[model samples]
Target: MLLHIQFSPEPIPAALPALSLGSETGAFVEFRGFVRGEEGDHTIGGLVYETYQPMAEREITRIAEALVVDHPVQAVRILHRLGPVPVGEAAICLGVAARHRAEAFAFLASFMDRLKKDVPIWKTDTLPAA
Candidate 1:
């Protein structure tokens, strides 16, 4: 499952049952991205994420397809947020499920890494200009 990218000051969705317990698979893994307190030499008060929607979605779909083809994972769900996000809030969330624990873990890790490196999302700090 994929989500429509959104930008809101409100908290991210609390219920991700489709990712957690929707599948009958024996294993599930989740990855969550949050706002950090620092970025490079700058202190981050918040973050703003922007994406070229069409391109970003396409890239994400490609990654998901690759994961299913290359891994034993049974299903995958990815969600990402945009706009102003404060510290401790989730920027992205990923979930993978499989029949075994090992595959679930491995696929989740790989997906996270690939998303960070390949996804078209861009982030900018909301810190005050020096």
Candidate 2:
């Protein structure tokens, strides 16, 4: 399996990288997380994402490796933005390629859940005046 991970200060790309699928590959899935300007009645001005770099990368790698070992996937890609991210901008992107759609969906969901629970990344949101 191919695994790619990047921590970028620049904007996330609009289009994620396409995987080179084998003849048996039949599904591709992606998840994109975007910064929002509001949550219910609260107003968000922006967000600052922080990470323990060495550990963050290691955790991401571990997640991908685990997916390869446990799932029927062909490739996985993850892009996460660090530092300041404005409202409406992309904060994270994930992609998965697999031999079937069900596996791709399952992997994507599980990977995201694991990332949120296990990754050492944190975010501070700038909120408008109350």
Best by TM-score: 2
Which 10-residue window in model 1 sums to the lowest lDDT? Answer: 1-10
Q: After superposition, which runs of candidate 2 have C-alpha atoms over 4 Å from their true positions?
A: 39-41, 127-130
In the range 1-130, model 2's lDDT, one tens digit per residue, is 8888889999998886666576877988889999888866778766889889899889988887787666778888888999888888899999888998888898888899999999999986564533
Provide the TM-score for each candidate, comma-separated.
Answer: 0.81, 0.88
Please give the distance, in angstroms, between residue 16's alpha carbon in candidate 1 and its true position after superposition.
2.8
Q: What is the overall TM-score of model 1 with all chains considered together?
A: 0.81
Q: Tell me the lDDT of candidate 2.
A: 0.84
Q: Over the stretch 1-130, how does candidate 1's per-residue lDDT look in tens digits?
A: 3323343446677667644444457877777888888777877777888877788788877877777666777777777787777767898877777777888888788878887898888886485433
Against the unseen true structure, what C-alpha lDDT does each candidate score?
Answer: 0.72, 0.84
User: What's model 1's lDDT at 42?
Assistant: 79
In candidate 2, position 117 carries an lDDT of: 97
